[model samples]
Target chain A: MANSKRTLAALVYNRPGVLNRVASLFRRRGFNIESIAVGRTDDPKLSRMTIVVIGDNATVEQVRKQLDKIVDVVKIIDITGDDMVSRELALVRVKATTATRAEIVQMVNIFRGAIIDVGSNTLVIEVTGDEDKIDSLLNLLRSYGIREVARTGRVAMTRGGTIGSIKAEEEAATGRQR
Target chain B: MKLSGARMLCQALINEGVDVIFGFPGGSVLPLYDVLPEFQGLRHILVRHEQGAAHAADGYARATGKVGVCLATSGPGATNLVTGIANAHLDSSPVVAITGQVARAFIGKDAFQEVDITGITLPITKHNYLIMNASDIGSVVKEAFHLARTGRPGPVLLDIPRDVFVEEAEFNYPDKVELTGYKPIHQGHPAQIKRAAELINSSECPVIIAGRGIIISDACEQLRELVEKSQIPVATTLLGMGGFPGTHVLSLGMLGMHGTAYANMAIQNSDLVICLGSRFDDRATGKVSAFAPAAKIVHVDIDAAEIGKNVRVDVPIVGDLKVVLQVLNTLVNSKSRPAWLEQIQKYQREHPLCVSSEEDKLLPQHVISQIYELTGGDATIVTGVGQNQMWCAQHFLYTRPKTLISSGGLGTMGFELPAAIGAKVGCPKETVWCIAGDGGFQMTMQELATAVQDKVAVKIAILNNGYLGMVRQWQELFYDKRYVGTPLWSPDFVKIAEAYGIPACRVKNKKDVSAAITTALSYDGSYLIDFMVEPEENVYPMVPPGASLAELMEHPDARRANASSTFTVSNV
Candidate 1:
């Protein structure tokens, strides 16, 4: 089967070396990670990680299982091809001449992006959207010579309220349930 | 209470119920050595080398089902433990390795005797930690033990800087670990268990391939119940020898590359393969494309990654084998397949493993059989990697769980002696035997001093063939009899044992083998016996690499004569 993109969110303990544990697993398994983003969750002790990978269903399922094996990982949910809200933040620095600045700003405005910084011959545009919208915006700015691009890989959650909160609560209810 | 980091480490180990540790002291771990005398509860076995310490700990863990502890210093000390750590990891042995690093300030400066021990061990360990502060010692130690012993047990590492050991801090051990991500699933899904049961009950030809998980999960009884209830034949992986009684009527012995011909035939002909906790390693399943072609495989393992990593599993149940088997035993119906049994008998009759009746010279198989006869297959046999391990696995019968403690997955040579010491220490009353090849015994022979010093009464059996027997067999079979780098020279093992202040003997004749074993068994303390056996002997029923299990060659010449005969007359 052809490989498809898979976006998975994991709630982990906010402890040092936890990220290394997760990252090392992927490196050790030789899994190609497209993008990853980590940030503190609503709970102070918990951190949420969004990881995008490209693989077949079996490969993605294996990645999910391997991630769950890490001691610091709390919960993992795959939101691929589901009714979910997904977004990616990209900071693109384009080589903007005076002639292309107005056109680039109009394109960014149309894509609902913002101008984060302005330089003599460059404009840093910040855009947050699904991968498709971000790709479309970046494609339009590519003609203006994109200097550099930084993206916080896709983060996703189910559209109908919290998907993992109930699971986490049930997991907590069973102390060392094995 | 305020305590130094070294004191905190000792207390934390004590809290985790660690009574003994195998270690070799070095420059970086001097702080730990200095404070070691203060703790009365923990006994330290000083090993000759860092690698010996790790293997000994691994052996202890495999024998006792407890997290074995080993300590080493930084840099070279930590580096030397890599092979043993990897051995434990591959074999699923629970071992906690602690190493001392350079002072905190000099960690990244390439200070003397400093190494990134954590980074070196990251891939091999289940998990690892580098302690920057003394206060974290308790929690780290707790977590390290927890991780090492829990769900698909493996080795864990803890690298502590020297400064952390000297720095004083208030000690508070956490009462509970709150790792949200570390839960191992123990219960099989009800639907999956039912499906497995249905497959088991309905299949006409069912075979069970048991693995090390049976011993690790303490599921031998459950496995036996399921097998007997379902009337399924059982074939064990190398490490899974004692999981099912080898003497049972339904037992097909070890299955794999050098597996019994009958066992391989059973697997090839079965309709359903119930893989309980055994990963279908390449050695076990030669040419996966042609392995068990007629069977629908049902794999039950604790680690989800092992399910479809090698062979595709039809019904995958990810959970503890004990729990899964318990549920399966209830769901399975008691029934017998007379036709299946008759077919297995036919295979067994056609390809019987024959031992030479002529006894002019000693044979390795005779020695193992004599050991089995004398011990009644009750002794815990630990073997170093080689033809000796294969002979022991094929000849000796294991009826008890955790009785055959060999390095299986890693095929690590030099594992038997130190591991025997650890096994003896772990199970003090059991008769522990270290069956090793002459080449492998010489690798860690220095550990004989540790065995004598610790007063561990482990009997040593060296199958002295004067060559790296297994490699010699391969060279003869595959490399056109070019015996390059296979011949070995060794120190007089009897003299070496005597130098260690232990009683020793040598058996050159076939008739003296039993007497020598009896003498070693009757001796009160440690004993070593070097059995001079035939050098040119080779393990048979080997499915050459990448060949189907159905194409097992009983001997090198048989492969050519029977190349086209899939089910023909056996050479034996």
Candidate 2:
């Protein structure tokens, strides 16, 4: 259910209860809210939420309508139905010693990820990119030995314009009225 | 102002409220046993084997939520508890197994009757301690109880060397316990509760799945209120049999491999599934890919790891079930969908469980219901694995938690008799019944002496079919009746119970049943009543092993359709 191409951008008042309302909508629908990134979107009074959700076209449309009804949500968008630029961050630690450490570092550089930290026997690498790029890098880094991994999942924005920034400002104006 | 280490151990145990302990003595534990005589109000059952002692403790723990305590001497005495300890560990039973070690001077010197019990049990226990000093005994014992009873409660071990028990010390038993690394978070975030409520309100069709956690957390009342107020139907796991009474309008009996068809259908068709304290076990979900395929799931549990471990949850709230359910109950509006409920009720009526025909010579359901009638649904019913276990669970009417005791997680055979002894001891006022199959009876039948010696006075009802009933039934259904190594020539159980100084009766015809049960229950001493049930009889309404709930097979009995099959079969 989490395997979906639709992306939704939600604007909410900068408060504690907004995330709950959004998550509850997806939970009640049995659809995995794949990736939800919430932060102040260039406005102090409001937060922008980018949600990557998986569902059919009808379900996606239903989710947007449902989110619009929630009190905290100022607006909802179906960005996947439009063009978008998506990026995600991941941190992976691989087992390494002097024996195979150099070979692994070279692979990390090729993936455009940085060697964040190093211990006597472990190397921690941080990478950020689209889902496909992250998957390819993980595949390339599996040879040296992956010990543990944590991913930030996917968060996206509209491409070729400051659409998310404008939407954030517009939602904040109406959020204060309620 | 001085105190002996032995006296300190007794004082610590009293402080921990250990009313009963099961143990066997040897050279190393002799001092502690000697001190036991001086401690008032604490009764210890001297079991034949240390293994039996450990199992008795486990049974006591499982029967009552309290931490069960057991003791043994060094080497063989301590080692005998391995099987029971492993059993307790696998089932997540709270047990504090105390074993003695050789004197401190003899430690690691290959001393006689010395074994590294703590090292041996490390992998099995949640945590273990080796007390080398007499001064530390009281505190360590206190900590052991604390650890065993809190946070996914599991068995803990304490092995003390003999010298520590004999040595003198200035004992100061602490009234309060403080552990740094062992705090379990109970209250969930307010935001999480609000979100869960929001999800429930928005869902068009929502079903609540409750588990043993509701009982463990003492949240059944709140959970019931939530489901009722929200107009949601509730399905429970096997361990959660009586969490919400099966008679409730919203109660959708047990759901799983052998679950009632309606409960499974309720989950499968629901638009949203709200799960409380239930781990989506393979049995509960059948094949995870097809389980509740239509629903979005919101999972609430105390353990974080359990979330998304089985069925992926859209909203995972890590908190106490009782707390979350109470919050949701208050927030959600009460609205019933009669149409949705009607659909489920149709499934319940159409796929009702099938009891064997009245004409059948020996059906287990009849035997169980007869036992229930004789005991008046108030006695504690314990069971061993396979057909007898399922039959007892299905037919027996239980009104209270812990009243129906069986090995749910491990499904261990040979658990009935010894466990019944433990249950009887735990609740001396209640009539305790052990319903076991022939195969499971002999495994720990030697413990019959414990009942006779302890004068527990519990009754043992043996469903003597001369075969491993459950496995044989499975072979009959799926394995083309190959019956490999399942058949056996049974011994005279009546004579065996008689040998232990307990009264015994045998029933080969239907008329002998009532008299046998009457004699067993009325007798002042322990009694064993053996009923030779039909060998070919099987537990019906079975969901074929590894099959989904939708694929449950009803019994071949035609009378079951009318629900008029009186539980009457020959007891002779």
Candidate 3:
């Protein structure tokens, strides 16, 4: 069977060794991660990490169970196939000539990409999309001599609502009340 | 000798033999962070969340059979540890969780960043303390560890206020702890032991049910000796999986939901039931009045409260399992095997609770049986919650204590991986197999790397059924199969395990089980085996909720209509 991966967005407290502890837990339990995006949450006290992992039903549940036990975690959500606005931002520097620049610009406009910076012979373009879209766009840009690419793994939210942050705050409020 | 309460607390933990602590730092605990550098020998792991810290500590405790420690600051930090603490309490794991509070002056004042951790965790922990005085800190710290590790091991919390840390106090550490309400009976009365043996000798057919207490008491050897001397067959609760090696002639595997047909049949047929170190959990006893209807019961346990808490006991002996077993073993005369064994064996052959067959595609039983076959009845197996744990108790042959690590009393789903890590750490040479369902494994999946990083070499087997299998079963049988909130669409496991540098495999058919097991067995580092099995299969021989044991719905093929109304089967 063809194998695939899933990503998880973990909202956790920003503290020392939090990443190591979470990483170590994943290593010990044997869950596999494809990519991880960690940055600041709305509250400066907490940090958010988007983890893309691969597992069958059993593997995913195992990850959920273990993650639930983590004390620093405010909330954990799996947005693998749910209806959601999922995007990753990547900056790629590709070699370009005047002849290629017009074509590149057309391709960028087609995918709604932005030309962030232009070097003498290299153009740094920023694109945001689902993982598959990014992969395809990267593939198209590869032919133009791709130099270096820095991609944000993934950041996701359910299409119509704000569930993660709200649930986390509710839990915090309930915890305080207790 | 000025110190933050957090620093002194860390020093106290170090004194208590705590080598590692899992927690998160926050506004309420910044003072401790500043002084953390001085505690050079103590290793602190900052968890991504407070809840993870609690679970890691619980995992550490279950694995090593020692007290695990977790820490967090006030409010949300303390609250995050609640689930982990509750999980430990359910599983009877020994863990210590310490959290910072707002200054004691503001305890009930609703100070900024303040939360009443003690009040919230009271029901979950064995004991909890709110430290208002710096002088009381030394004693409270000592008491927390003592309470957590003693008696029926469980989590204990110590909530330290911010001001207490900076205050000066005499460095007096009491040499002992004394609690009036906490006296645990460790030795059974001689008269009671004699009476228990007398009942055993006189009964036409007697059966023994052992639980985790045997393992906790380190009395597996004694239990084996007693079982052999008396020629009594033994059945265990889910937590008691490794308490008796299932290879013994008298071992009747697990009893109760998803239990062996023979074990439940034996319980039904016996005249006298001798229960040791095991509580009569609703899952085990199944409709109390209907359970062991013909049997006169003798219950032995260290916890007095557990006695008569579930099932009525003819005789209750409260004490340490080892001491009680030793006394009982010496008192009971060497007796011949009861004819009941023959009848149970006949039932075993007739009903035989085997889950694998050519007729079914990939079943959970097939994968479990293959793992059992490959291990050859010698490996230590750990389980997470739900059907997978019941399956191990039913199928895997447990030969010794610590062999089958599971969160039984607490039924915490994510316990297997961390427990297996601790077990491997305690016994490095022994192979530890962690078996879990999709729901259970995900609870503590974060601990996977700890196994790899520590070179724990634990093997993981995931039985994937694409749902919260256990709850889904309950919903199907009792709640009209609405199947609300149970569906699980999963990601491919192989690629994920590989990313963390662990060997991984996926098995979708029965034919692939052996190969998957072989690959996991041979891999030098940690390995993950994902076995995709049939969903919608419920654990049978179920005594419908609130129904008596006699009212069990046994064998779907032989399910009696109106089974919950009576003990007798008219047709049979």
What is the docking quality class of candidate 2?
incorrect
lDDT of 2 by residue, B287-351 (tens): 77777887888998776656776676888887887777777787888777778878877766666
Q: Which parts of model 1 are misplaced by more than 4 Å?
A: A165-178, B356-359, B556-572
- Candidate 2 Cα lDDT to native: 0.78
Give the 10-residue window scoring lowest on summed lDDT in candidate 1 chain A. A169-178
What value does the lDDT take at residue B20 in candidate 2? 92
lDDT tens string, model 3, A1-178?
Answer: 3345766777776865467656765776576667788887655766878887776744564565456444456566677777767789999899999889989988988889999999888899999998898899899999999999999888876677555543545346334341
Between candidates 1 and 2, name the one with more favorable TM-score.
1
Candidate 3, B1-572: lDDT as tens digits: 65556666777888888887777898777777777778986767665567767876876676567788888999999998888899888767799998889987887899888987877785577767778777777778888898888887889998888777677776546888744224567889888999999998788788889888887778899998988888888988877777887777788888876666678788888998999888888788877878988899999988765777678789889899999988889888888864777787776655555442334488786677778789786777888888887777666677767677777666777767766765665566888898989887777676776666656688999999999998998899889888999998766767767776788888888788998898888878689999888987666567678775556566564333222323221101
lDDT of each: 0.89, 0.78, 0.77
Worst 10 residues of 2 chain B by lDDT: B563-572
Which docking class does model 3 fall in?
incorrect
Candidate 1, residue B197: Cα displacement in angstroms equals: 1.7
Index of the highest-lDDT prediction: 1
Each model's DockQ score: 0.53, 0.02, 0.01
The candidate 1 chain B region of ten consecutive residues with least summed lDDT is B563-572
Report how far off residue B540 is in candidate 3 (Å). Answer: 3.7
Instruction: Sort candidate 1 into its docking category.
Output: medium
TM-score of chain A of 1: 0.88
